[model samples]
Target: MEFTITNVILLFAVLLVIAVITTKFSSRLGLPSLVFFIAVGMALNHYIYFDNAYLAQLFGILALIVILFEGGLTTKWCHVRKVLLPSASLATIGVIATTLIIGFFATYILELEWLEGMMFGAIVGSTDAAAIFAVLGNKNIRTKLKATLEAESGSNDPMAIFLTVSFITLIQSHEMNFLSLVLSFFWEMGIGLVLGLLWGKVAVWMINKINLDSSGLYPVLSLALAVLTYSTVSFVHASGLLAVYVMAIFVGNSDLTYRTSIIRFNEGFGWMMHILMFILLGLLVFPNQLVSIAWQGMALALLLMFVARPIGVFLSMMFMKYSFQEKVFISWAGLRGAVPIVLATFPLIAGLEHSQMIFNVVFFVVFTSALFQGATISVLAQKLGFTGETKAPAPYSLELVSIGRTNSEIVEMTIEEGSAVVGKELRELELPEDTLITAIIRGNKIVTPRGTTSLQAGDILYVLVTKAQRETAKQIILEG
Candidate 1:
């Protein structure tokens, strides 16, 4: 039955309510709510559907845009800079290596044809930044390792998308002309890079130039630009994900008048996207079909976990000074999520043979990744001895004053493992004159202030300080 406009709105309303309830249940069960969201989607498909695959895909794209944009916005330039070289190299090189290495294993061990085996490899190469940020955003891990994971997840998807689409094309045409393939891949990525940077610069200029007084309207404007950037870049055969991410990052880190509102809007949108993507993809999966390939998927997943991911991490970062534990976390951090499954849809839509099998294998890989990696990241972080502070960002505040001319300040502090402030009252700490710990986002909770506030490590503080006494204020906070 076709859903009318009223029905569509009602359906979404019902889904949202269910999402909140399901997430609550999943949290109590020690699981990622994403799994329950997938189950909800499958259940809905049994009794109801959107009546259009295109609609499902449309929602998927919207979700990815929000997810990537939020990631870009939250990504700190300094955090990524420290592990920049390793992270960038891992995203690029590790993606390629995992694909080919797993490809060969599929061909030899699974006794599949070369093309199909490569298809499986290509499907699983990239890590999902959405999943990483969703799970790890709340953890208290070291800054360096977290940066490495976040940056890798943020950048690797485009490369994996490139590889998957490229392999699909090769399978259809039976042509693997090496030079053409290499050139085309580089060209596409190059276009995405150039276009993304260009679009971001232009968008920011327009945003800052147009003095929009309505804080609410500014988020709408930026979001419109984000969608436009994706469409325009993809229409020209560039990476839409790349373009949206860059545009969002530029808009996010810039001095916009309504930066807080914009960030809030995008963050909410990102969550909705995640829920929608997982649910729709889950509906596409047939649990019965997955059983037949159970062993095959398990074997391939084991190879990826035990062999491909770790070797890629160690080899790529051999020159780096990462400890053994950091290396293990790096390997474990290569968790796949909805991106590979989303890419799996490509082969099916194109009517490739064994596409369903490909989809199921992709499903298995993603499932194991989320199940294993998501559950153990915090414990692994502690075990690895890189227990560096990962202070979450403080609550966002909006003000109209010019920060440069005014006496307002931004003070930075690191929370130690055993500081007195760990469980003390903020009032007792005697925070200095006119300084507000405006935001105290522990994990993802933006803590509202009171006299009984207890500080925790990995909590980012956006302190509004006195410009003249900013240095002195930093000393007081850090010392305490």
Candidate 2:
């Protein structure tokens, strides 16, 4: 069939529908929807010409900005704070370790140059944000572990990006010596950190104080802020990716009007970008070429999942209070997704030696990760006793809002099994003055709290609290 405008539109509509259905069945099948997305892209490759790595890189960069922004916007600062130091170590040191270990193996076994091997390692280094977010949403992992995994996945992209770009420069000119590389790392990360923190505050202030005339324009304004942060930071030779994540987190946690709407918008937008990005990358691959790299791909994937990742996790968390089982879970949770494939585009655009080989190997590793790790994560959690009864979705809707450092705020939370708030009477919980449990919904029943009312494991509490008591209320409920 010859291509036409109508046909293209219909094809896109079909793919969108398939994307939704793929997500609906993803958890049931123990497969991340990413597999289905990439499969679609591969299927379409025969019908279209999408072998342009340059174009793919541009689109990938934009999609990643959106993904990281949404990640920051949705993450709670309190949870991030708990895992901040350890997760930061993993994002920075863990990445370097993974890259060096994998790079050494690739250099020895594959007979590649040291720099080329490192490039391949750096390309596949990070745990993908899109994959982790999608898979974890369906699991019942504990709060701290989940937060650490999320924080690591969300923040580690910059390290991989730095390594990839640095190696590409070295492979091209061979002039970027060790001292220059170290200096570049500090220059990029230092600028990124400062700009991200500074702009995050500015973005939050703008969102809260701008008070757009139409509610619809608020999300648009937020989107603009994200793009502006990334582009402006990148132009100054800093890590724009890091800036987006930091800015999103700050704005997400701030007291802004219509915050929920902004979050909802970004979630939907991020999903669309994920779908499009994966499909496009898939379209760029030639399955026939993948056959030649099959054995090498499998070997590298196994070593990554079994050896290198565990080493990185154990070393990174050495001084932390994680148990053996928790370390094992984190090691197994290093599922690669689109990030590596997108990074592969860097080498391809750089026109370096072995670039195509690197791309093919990365595609295969991502496939294995999605098929193996993505499928087994939930089961592994259960095996290690890290999972509890999955929280059921809230049956009713609620929204909380306050303005300008006011003491009044609304909080909705599910009382997990074994949480401190569970099995305690409202009076015994000893909530702060002016803090009220407005209502408790258990299963399908709604109970107005009495002094003697006892909270259950599955109880969903609608709390109205003053700012002074917000942190205290959260500590009480989530302490379990």
Strongest candidate by TM-score? 2
User: What are the Cα lDDT values of the candidates?
Assistant: 0.75, 0.86
Which sections of candidate 2 miss by over 4 Å? Answer: 398-480
lDDT of 2 by residue, 130-236 (tens): 78657766567898889999899988999999999998888889775898788888888889988998888988777666644455567788888999999999999
State the lDDT of candidate 1 residue by residue for 63-86, as single tens digits: 788788888888887788888899
TM-score attained by model 1: 0.79
Error of 2 at 232 (Å): 0.8
Poorest lDDT segment (10 consecutive residues) of candidate 1: 396-405
- lDDT for predicted candidate 2 compared with the true structure: 0.86
lDDT of 2 at 212: 47
lDDT, model 1: 0.75
